[model samples]
Every structure is written in structure tokens, then in C-alpha cells.
Target: MSPTSDLLAAALAQSGFHPRLPQQRRLYEAAKAAIHQQRLGAGGKLPSSRDLARDLGMARNTVIAAFEQLAAEGYVVSSRGSGTYVADLQAHSASMRGVGATPQGRSTAPAATPSARLSRRGQELTSYAAGPQFEIQPFAPGDPDFSSFPFKLWQRLQNRVWREARNDLLDYGQSGGHLPLRQAITEYLRISRSVKVEVEQVMITAGTQQSLDLCAQLLADVGDTAWIEDPCYWGARRVFQARELKLRPITVDSDGIAIAAADLATKPRLIYVTPSHQYPTGAVMSLARRRELLDVAVRKDAWILEDDYDSEFRYTGRPLAALQGLDHDDRVLYMGTFSKVLYPGIKVGYLVVPPALIPAFRSALYDLQRPGQLTVQATLADFITLGHFTAHVRKIRQTYGARRELLRHMLAQKLPRSVTISREESGLHLVIELPDQVDDMALAQQAAMQGISVKALSTYYLKPPIRRGLLVGYAYCTPEQITDYGRLLGTIIAAEAAA
Candidate 1:
């Protein structure tokens, strides 16, 4: 059959629409739409896998796999000499008219099914609207400007680690992490964040997400209350929810997590806070609130998990001390990630527990956590100890600071008076609060149509009637891209407000 015939046949078969996988279903729907729209006409040759992949902005393998599946189902025909062809779909259309129904005249698929498997706790999650075009922007949250990383210095340190590393580095070094890296982290946290902990108190995790998971496992029993911030980080909330913990959201103010007059009726066993720079909202926890929270934790005998992600990128004024620094009763468990400072793919983050809890935490981690690659940890330790890590942080701090300023300036120029931009002092993201009339989720979806990615703050909330705001990230985008993105976002927001 000709290429057009094969394409038509595949489209016709897919129109019957019993896709086992959601991704496969999406591909089938897209293919059917293309055929029905006459994009793939009878006798017309279908595009090559490479061409289709390029056009669709998908992996070549994905396109090839889709085509192969279609061919296997007798929807398309492929030959050795001629390219793949659309099958004569008209021959099958009549027979497929009733294929949507089962033999007993009922729908084959259920109306509702279980959701996809949950990702690990605290994993960096991209918004639903984030696509290739969204990624093309300069500074989206959770991304570091990899181009700014000092690869040459990193390579040299890696070489040295390889030269000096012992055979034991090849094996599983430790459940906590490589000893040297743990030692380095212990020292670094003590000096930098005022987190008092010994090398034994530090446990290396896959990132902040794993740290959250480890904490959840160690402290929270199912159905226990875990207090999270209102409009908090979605990943953390999901982690708590996955463990079947009841999530209690506390409202946040300018100084950060507002625990005053909070409904403690649930009597939460754990409190998760991003004190350095609050996630999404970017509000720094004030010294008073930090002290108040520590007091509350002590009173309630609750464990506090302080996620210090992106604390190293403070652009304006001095960096605030970590919440763990203010803990007097050893109730705070501090978590830090190199994912933001070094790179995301490194999958290296450290958790500092109280001295008394170290043994139990370590024991639990060893039992449940998969130890990271020893060689990488050893190399990373050498990088930090040799001062390359500090130097890289210094360089990127300046770069991110410049980009933050540029983004803020652009927003001020483009955005209306009603739109409020929050806390551009530190971290990769700023929260844009729109007028109450505008729906942030709808605005984000609309922006996606224009190839601009923006996150709605409402999705992070667990309670009903969510807030309306956008989380704008600037870690990956360049200055120019930020300007363009700002203008585009301003236009979208303005249009939405008017509508």
C-alpha cells in the first residue's frame, strides 16, 4: 500500500481508541486528528521518522515506536524499499464503527482508574504546561544555568578524586554517603548555616525530596498531622499525602510561616518549612517567626523539616540564617541540596539531624535508602574541599543576581499596577499575585498556548477555593529572554484581567 494508505489505516484503527497507555492514547488521538484534517491524505507519503520527530519536537525513537505500533496493528504498511505508507483505511472504517463498544455492549475502559505511581518525596516537579518552548526560556524555577558552571574546575577535581580514591570507593561506601562528603557537609553546614551537627549527624540523600521521604518515614505514622505552608511546595505536600499523612496548611505572611493563632487542633507531629526563602512565595522567615515556630515545635514535640533549597542565591541584602540555626531544643532537621548550587542532575543533598537522633535516623536510612554512587560523592567532596565549590558559587551568585535584577526591572516596566511581585531578593522564583478576578490556573493554561510557561500558585494548596498567583522562575533564562518573557506574560495577564 502507499504511504497515505498506511497512514489512513493507522488513523482509522486508532479512532476506535482503546489505548493501553495514556501517552499512546495521546499519540493515537493526534494521528487521528491529522488524518481527519487531511494533513495525511490518501496515497500521500507519510513523513519519515526523523522528520516527524523534528516536527513534533519528540524523540526520534518515540516517533519510530509509534509508527511500529501502528504497523503491527495493521493500520500502516512498511516495506524494505519504499517508505512507510498510509493503509487504505476506508476498507476498515465500516467494521470499526462499533468497535468502541465491547461484545456485551459496555465500555471496555472504566470511567476512573488509579493514578500513575507517585514520584519520590520532594522531587522537583515541573508544571503541567511546561513544554519544550517553556524550557527554551532563560530562568524557569528548579533549573540552574548549567552553562555558568565551572566544568573545567569540576573535571580537574574529578580527575584528582579518581587518582586518589581507594578501591572501596568502587563499592557501596556507606548508606549515609561517602565519609569525606559527609564530613565536608557537616563542616559546611556548621559554619555557613549555623547548624550544629557532627559528621555522624549528616546523611546524604538523593536530594531534598529523598530527605523529606526519609524524615516522613522516620517520624510520621500514617494519619498523623503534618503541617505545611499554605501555597506551599507541591512536591513536599504530595510526599506527605502519599504517606497518608493528614496535611495541615498554615497561612504565610511577609515574615514567613505564620503559626500564630493556627488551628493546632490536629496537633501536628511534623512541620515542613522552607525558611531560607519560602518556596513559591519567596518570603523569608523572620527571626521572630523562626523563634516562635521552634517554640511551637518544642511545645508540640514536633519535628521540623527545614528545606534550605536555593538559599545560596541571595541577590539583595544579606542572606538570612537558616531556621535550623535558631533551634535550641534540637527539634529542627535541616536539609540542603547541591542541586540548585551545583546542578540538578547531581542528585546530591544532605540532611542534618539532631545529635540525639543521628543513630536512629542513620539506622533507618541504611535500611530503606539506596546509597548513592560512591565515586560521584567522593569527587564532589574533593570539589568542595579543594575550594572549587565555593568559587563556583561565587561566580554564579553574581550571574543570578544580575538576571534577577533584569527580570524585576522588566516586570516593573511591563506589568500593571495591580500585579504584585514578591521577594526577588533570593531564590530562582518570584510569586506574581494577580487581581482577585483573574484565575491563575486558567491564565497559565492560556500562556502555554503562546509557548510561555508559568505556574499557578493554587495547585500547591490542599484546601478548597485556591489562591490566584503565578510562580515565575528566572534561574535558567538569560536576561534578554527574561525581558521577552516578562512582556509576553504582562500581555497575557492584562488580557485576562480585562476579560
Candidate 2:
């Protein structure tokens, strides 16, 4: 048999081509697979129909039809007088191929690996760790108490929207999201978080993650400096990095991002801050720091991304207002998510852009991400307007507050005096700062083995970890589990310290 026929036969068997298929289709698919797999080289001559048919025990007509199909699909070329030849796809395939095909018309290179197929940026982006795991094990940070969400009411609202579903609701929704949801969000933000936003400026996103991605793409150019809080949210760091931005990690103090004369000289194009409630550390940005940051943004012509995630559950004094509310220069881009308050699977969040930038942001969000889930957006609008959202927040705040206190009490009572627990006045998780000798990452791993799901605080940092701590969550754990797992975690820490 000819080399082409041998490859075609092998590919047919290896590809699991069904024998029951029509001979023409089977031969066509087998030939195409061999060509795609580069077993058939560019410009290689195909065997005569009669010879291939006889070799494969197929009718000549079947082989002729298969060749014609391949030619029609540009997989093969015919010169009228000369026999058909495999199309020269080398130019188009160069990006996907290593070196080149061998003399036998087969690729000597290994399978196309990620390093070969993905772009430089894509390869670098994939190296970072993914977002939080959702196992909801004891002390898992970033997960709200799912058991307490009013699923029955949510189902009823979703069903109502579906039952009355109009063409607009079912179609590609407005890039700014469902109008009612935007209006609802505007009202809630103005009243609760003290954000200054109009309904027109609101653009719904998949969540804050998508919001970060949109900001990275729209606001800053490649290599532009972005000021990120050191020991920041890993997801935000990844998003900024994905856009190829230069990250300037600003150290965080009791008051949000500590600005230095050097940092002001750096003059970043974008500044990301979680001012209301800092992640892991839970330090609320003081009013003075908020104004100073705003001033810096104005002076540098920069944009501030204020991620107000999980600020609704404040147990202490009045929650500090969002940084966006303080921005007189319209340099702040406020981001909020229902994921932490409701559930992660809900996948609804909003970005409040400056009024003038709304059109560009809306168009970019639609063009790039095409935010949808209109039905869910509609349901969330109802949840907020009908007072369910307020009641739910109030109830969970009380519940999470009790849980937070119980866990704090347990840790204080059981752990060594050297182990300091900060008063995490707001948010779902708290950091347990350990002595410098303790390896927080190793402690987290040990806790994971015992079905605890805390995060090592050091991993969140952009610089070498200066602090050793474990981030333990309370919102997802029931009161009983807090007492039980809290003791277990304390015991583990004590043992590690003793060692």
C-alpha cells in the first residue's frame, strides 16, 4: 500500500471511525484526521483512487468521492491533469506546530503543548493559582452561609420572571444589565454604602472578577503601572497581571494603602483598593486616607477601583463610607458583588463608572464579556426592592456576628497568648496572626488534612511575606462547628508552636 493509504488506514482505526458509516464519509474523515494530525504533509501527493481503493478493499467510486470532498474543503488541491495533493497548510499551521514534519509526512514533534499553543501572556497568566475552592469545609474563607439564603423566595421570583418572560428578557440583555437591577443597585449603594452613582452609570458584570478584568482592559494600557494593595485579593492581582500591567504593591497599614513620597512619584495609572473592609486583614480605610488616595488619583490622572466586597456585615461601629463617595474628580470606579452577600453561584456584580465613561464602558463590557443573566438580574432587583435583601442582610449580619464572636472567643481561650486575633469588624473572614517562627502555609496544609479550609495569609502578598498568619472564616460555619473546629484549629496551632 502507498504511504498515504497506510496513514489513512491507521488514522481511521486510531480515530475510532465507525465502520457502519458510509464508505465515502469514513474515508473522508480518516483522510482529514491524518492531514490535521500532520501525518499527511503539505504538498504531498495522494495515491491514485484505484490504487487506494484496491489497497483498502473499497470501491474506486468511494475513494474518488472522498478525494473530491477533501478538495472541496481545501484539505487537498487538484491540478486537473496531475493527481490531488495535500494542501500546503504549513504557513497556517506554523503557530501550532513545533519544528516541522518529518520526511515520512509525520510530525516528529510531541503533541502541541500549552507552551507552544498559548501566547506568552496566556502562558504567564495560567501559572498563577485559581480563586478560592468551594468545598465549604470548616473555616473555609470566602464562602457565605449558603444554608441561610432564602432559596424558596428566590425561586418564586425567578419563576415569575420566566413566566412573564418577554423577548427582551430572553434576548441579549442591555450591556448595562437589566435596567431595574441598575436602578435598584443605585438606590442601595446611595443609601447603604454612600456611593455616588446614577442608574445610567451602572454596568452589571459577571462578578467583581469580571469587573476587574474590564477595568484592566479599558482604563490602562499594557505596561501601565497599577497600584495594588500588598497582601491584596489574589483574584484582583491575577486580573491586573493578565492585562500585562506593571503592579506597584503599596503596603497596607491600619488605614488602607499607605502612600509614600516614592509611591506618589511612581504615579500609577490605576489604583486598586478594598477601603471599606480590607481582605484577610480587615482594616477599614480611615477617612483621611481615603481623601489622600483620591487626591493622588486626581494628581496622577489615575483611576481608583474600590472593591466593596462583604462590607454589609459590619459588627462594630458604623461602616466607613466607600472611597468612591469621596471622589470629587470622578476618578473612582466602584465595584460591588452579590456573591459574598448571597452566593457565589449567583454571579451578579456591578461596576459604577464615572458618568461620562459609561458609554465606552458599556460598549466594552458588551463587546468583550457580553454580560447576561437577565432573568437573574431581574430576580435580584426584586429581592432588593421588595425588602427581602435588607432583611436577609440584617439576619445574616446578626448570625455571622454571633459566629465571629464565638470563633474569636474560642481562639483567644485556646491558643497561646502570642497568637493575636485582630478585631475583624467587617467581612466574612479574619486573620489569625501567628508568631514569626510558625509557617502559616504549613499550618494551613495541616489544617486542611483535618477538614479545615483556611488560607495562608502570606500567599496573598505581592512581596516576600513579612507577616505569618492564617485566614480563618466564620460566616460559612455554623455556631456549633465554630466551637468544635475552632478548638481543633487552636490545638493544631499549639502543637505546631510547641514543635
Highest-scoring model, TM-score: 2
- Residue range 1-499, candidate 1, lDDT tens digits: 4454355346545654555555544565556466446576534456777776655556778777877776665445565446665544543432345333222333221111111122333222332322343345433466788888878877887787789857887875455789999998887887777787888889888889889998998898999999998878877886787677988989877788887564665698999999888887888888888888998898898999999998888876767778887788999999999999988888889899988887877777777775647788988988888887778888888988887778778877767888878755888777788888888899988887876677888777766534578887777787778888877887788777777
What are the models' TM-scores? 0.75, 0.80
Off by over 4 Å in 1: 1-139, 260-262, 465-467
What's the true lDDT of residue 489 in model 1? 82
* lDDT accuracy of residue 208 in candidate 2: 98
What lDDT does each candidate get?
Answer: 0.75, 0.85
- Tell me the tens digit of each residue's lDDT in model 2 across 122-169: 878777757555556988788899999998999999999899957787
Range of the 10 consecutive residues with the lowest summed lDDT in candidate 2 = 107-116
**Model 2 ranges off by over 4 Å:** 1-100, 105-115, 131-134
Error of 2 at 492 (Å): 1.2
